[model samples]
Target: MPIDTTPNAAIQRSLRQCLSNAAFMLYQQGHVLETITIPFRGLDGSALRQLREASREWPACQQVLESSEAAVYNEHGRFVLTAMGRELLFDMFGQGAADCA
Candidate 1:
């Protein structure tokens, strides 16, 4: 499969903005990205909009995000991290992303 290697500053910023909503420490099964969605408060409007725009073209965004291994909301409506996402989260926060959880 072809990968979108082009730099997507918008998506990257959106991903970072989404991550800002919740605190972090480390990642377990679904720690880092999961925190963005809670029963009471889900992703903020801006973050959601950003994601929507980034994901407007599913295949395109998939290639782009997957290339960078970013955390994304899958078609199943679940937030999942790619390989880079895990590493990125760990780099940003150590141990577990449960500080605010």
Candidate 2:
């Protein structure tokens, strides 16, 4: 068998999935993932940290959000999803059972 040379690709896919899931959860609750505080008590600390890190480094995800002005840091230094973010969440997770209300 050949060596797995696509570790970063796999990680990126997983990161996108995780971030999409987190965004959907927040959308359902009319909230957004914030850096200043943990959005969900049940969310794994490491996963949350990874999501935050991806928000800064992931070009596809971060660039889209930033270009659309969807992801923004509030005055208190917390990352909150804007209205456009909700729309982007819908695109990422699909118009599934997650209510983006």
| Deviation (Å) of 58 in candidate 2 | 2.0
| Estimated TM-score for each candidate | 0.33, 0.36
Model 2 CA lDDT for position 86: 51
Candidate 2 Cα errors over 4 Å, as ranges:
1-60, 91-99
lDDT (0-100) at residue 69 of candidate 1? 54
TM-score winner: 2
For lDDT, the strongest prediction is: 2
The total number of steric clashes, by the backbone 3 Å criterion, in model 1 comes to 5
lDDT (Cα atoms) of all candidates against the true structure: 0.46, 0.49
How far in Å is the alpha carbon of 50 misplaced in model 1? 11
Report each candidate's C-alpha RMSD, comma-separated, in the order given: 10.4, 10.0
Which 10-residue window of candidate 2 scores lowest in summed lDDT? 35-44
Candidate 1 residue pairs in backbone clash: 25-96, 25-97, 26-95, 26-96, 26-97
